[model samples]
Target: MCGIVTAIATNNVVPVLLEGLRKLEYRGYDSAGLAVLAGELTRLRSCGRVAELAALADARQLSAHIGIAHTRWATHGVPSERNAHPHISGGLAVVHNGIIENFESIKADLQGKGYVFESETDTEAIAHLVHYKLQANTDLFEAVRQATNELVGAYAIGVVAEADPFRVIVARRGSPLLLGIGEDGMYAASDTAALLQVTRKIVYLEDGDLAELRRDSYIVIRSDGSPVEREVHISSLSADAVELGKFRHYMQKEIFEQPQALAQTLELIAGGAGITPQHFGARAGEVFDGVRRVLVLACGTSYHAGLVARYWIESIAKLPVTVEIASEYRYRESVPDPDTLVVVISQSGETADTLAALKHAKALGMQRTLAICNVPESAIVRETALRFITRAGPEIGVASTKAFTTQLAAFALLTLALAKINGRLSAEDEERRLAALRHLPVAVQKVLELEPEIEQWAQRFAGKEHALFLGRGSHWPIAMEGALKLKEISYIHAEAYAAGELKHGPLALVDKDMPVIAVSPADELLEKLKSNLQEVRARGGELYVFADAGSEIPESEGVHILHMPEHYGMLSPVLHVIPLQLLSYHAALVKGTDVDKPRNLAKSVTVE
Candidate 1:
């Protein structure tokens, strides 16, 4: 994923462009650049963070009435000044997000036409193609639209033509782009957070929609050049929501926000006596009635949420569920039934692979669809028939914390709703389930209190190069999520295995130097999990167990116990994952690693 911000204003837009880039840096930070049109196209590129780019801009006294800026997560080329965005060809400067699958053929054609290519980026090809289109049509909007017609694959591009200095042409297909209406100017960005300071009114562009932006006005048109009206939504997000008030990093702020996040996500049920299917959407009860099975499509942390959902849906709803990684599922042939409900999970709801997979499922005649997402205006939310918007607002960390727990909270409600609809849940059981959900925030708050203890454990983990995470049943996915968090932030080589699978092969790697972290909930599998922990101890592996309160597990020389407040039956995964996240966060701190913007990772995966 990359971030793009464009502004056409009466006053100098250099400051606006720079501020927007700073807000959007979580999307990508490999390099940053800006292109402004004063008398001609003035371009500045940097292979550094936005701060360095700002320094360069100040040194050069860059100022313009219209400009576009980008912070990139490199795709087609390595991170360098030459590979940064604002890829220029003749008079056209283009900044883009998403992949161009047919770039090789397009690049060859452009090269054959005697056009010189500067950077090894697909984005450079778009600039040349738009410049080429300008020769036939003098209008910049028409040139961008015509050039896009010849290109394939996903793109959200902002183009500024030297001839049309006051105007910016933007187009989107399979990537997020939106226009912000401001009193002084018109703004376009991949995310609303970028333009929050300038505007609160946003117009989300549809696929293949091309827009021409100028000071105080913007016009949106369809691919066929037909004019259309897009509704402008009043954004609830404030500039303060993105600020890191007193926290060292956004990750820490988000970790503490889980209590409020969960509370807001579960607000509809917190005061209710029982749960209902209508909590999902107006048409959810009808959609759930037709669902005979469920197929979950997601990627990354969202995929792990889907894996945990599998156990809930099958056990509570008595529905067969298959969780598939969206990236893999979209490219493979699979059985798709119209009666099957396809549930897609994403924090941004603009995840490229998950969105493609949703379209793929719909193409195969699966009409029943649902989205569990954080953003209310995201593409995945609009594409699905039903949706549950998690209240985990603006997760800036590349490694998710509040978003994951909120997804689990949303999934728990979905499971209860389905169970109630199918008669699997009795009235008494439903009340009990609802009670557990109502107290989820309090339970999560109790878990947050254990952070100090977990931080102490992190000291032991920080110096280690490798670790193992073990759990059984539904907690297996929790273990996997734990391993992912540790590896992602701390750069530790970590792996997770179902406790039952330990004897199969993984037990061989256990030693005194290796830390074995176990999720030991007091369920029926606790004894078996204890045996797995013993297998590690027998081989001199240091065991760090997060056990249920009142569990028989004893603390000894190598066996360390961190007791959870309570053993939540089905909702344990949500609570158990908190300490693991804390451990990873503290471990990353101990190692002095970047916790928010981890290496080679962006917060959003908007590209394939």
Candidate 2:
């Protein structure tokens, strides 16, 4: 994933471009650069973060009325100054997000046409192609549109030509792009958060849409060279929501924000009101009525959320559920039924693999689809007939915390809604579930109180190179999430398994050097989980168990116990993941690694 912020303002836009790039920093990047049209295409590049780029700009006194900035995550080349974005060719400068799949052929053709390349990047091909088009026509917008016609893959680009210094040309064809209507000028960025400071009014661009931005106005064109009108809606995001207030890092801030996040996500249900099918969307009743089976598709953490929902839907609604990794499912042959409801989960709602898989399923006649996502204006939410927007606010951390918990909360509501629609949930049971849902925020607050103890537990893991997590039944997914958190932030090699699978092969890897973390909830599988812990103990493996209150697990030699504040029954997974997240955060803190921007990872995966 990369970030793009372009502006054609009346005033010096160096500060605006830098601030926008800072806002988009959470999306993850290795290099930062900017090209400003100050009579000529002048660019400054850095091989580090936006801070370094800002410093370079300050040292050189870079300023302009129109500019394009990018935070590169390095898809096509190594992270270096030359590979950083704002790639220039002839008089055109371009910054891009997403991939150009057929860059080799295009690069070959351009090279034969005497186009010299400076960077080894697919985006360099775009700059050359645009410059080539500019030779035929002087209109920047027309040239960009004609050049994009030859591209074969996803892209959201911001291109500026020195000949047309007052305008910025932008196009979107798979990745996300939007235009910001500001008081003095026009802006374009990859996310709403990037433009929140300058303007709240946004116009989201669809695939194959090109736009030309000027100081006072803009124009939109379709791929077929026809003019199109795009509605400008007000963005609901606030600038303060993304600030790291009082917390040291965004990861810590997000972990502690879970209680309030759950409150906001469950606001409709937390008042003890009855749950209904309409909670999802206006057309949920029509879709759920004919759905005989459920297929959940997602990637990464969202995929793990789907795995947990598989248990909830099948056992509660009595409907068979299948969870598939979206990247794999899109390329494989799968049986699709007309009566099946396909649910795609994503925090950003623009996950490339998940969106492609949703289209793939729709192409196979699975027409009844729903998207559970956070962004209201995202492409996936717009593509689906129904959607449940998770109010987790802005999850700025690369490792998700509040977003994952809110997704689980959304799935719980979906499960109860479907069960009630099928006449399986009684009135009294529904009320009980609603009451439990209302109490989740308070319960999560109590779990957050265990952070000091979790920090102490994390101290033991500062020197650890590997970890094993265990859980039973629904908690198995929680265990998997915990392992993912640890490995994602701390760079530790971690894996999770169902408690029953220890004797098969994992038991052999257990020893004193490896720490085995277990989610010991007081569910039906507690007795069996205790036996599995004994298996670890017999193999001389140290234990770190997050047990329920009043559990019988003793804190002895190799066994360390951190009792949860409460037992949340069916919603225990949400509470159980809190301490694991804290564990990873503090462990990464002790190890002195980058907690917010983990290496080789992006917060939103916009490219395949």
TM match of model 1 to true structure: 0.99
lDDT of each: 0.93, 0.93
For 195-264, candidate 1 gives per-residue lDDT tens digits of 9989999999999899999897899999999999999999999999999999999999999999999999
Evaluated at residue 362, the lDDT of candidate 2 is 96
Query: Could you estimate the TM-score for every candidate?
Result: 0.99, 0.99
For residues 1-608, what per-residue lDDT tens digits would candidate 2 score against the true structure?
89999999989999999999999998999999999999888999998889999999999898899999999998998999999999999878999999999999999999999988888899999999999998999777888999999999999999998888889999998899999999989999999999998999999999999999999999999877899999999977888888998999999999898889999999997555789888889989999996899999998888889888888889899899999999999888788899999999999988999999999999999989999998998999998989999999999999999999999999999999999988889999889888988999999999899999999999999999999999998899999999999999999999999999999999999999999999999888999999999999999999999999967888999999999998888889999999999999999999999999999999889988
Stretches of model 1 off by over 4 angstroms after superposition: none
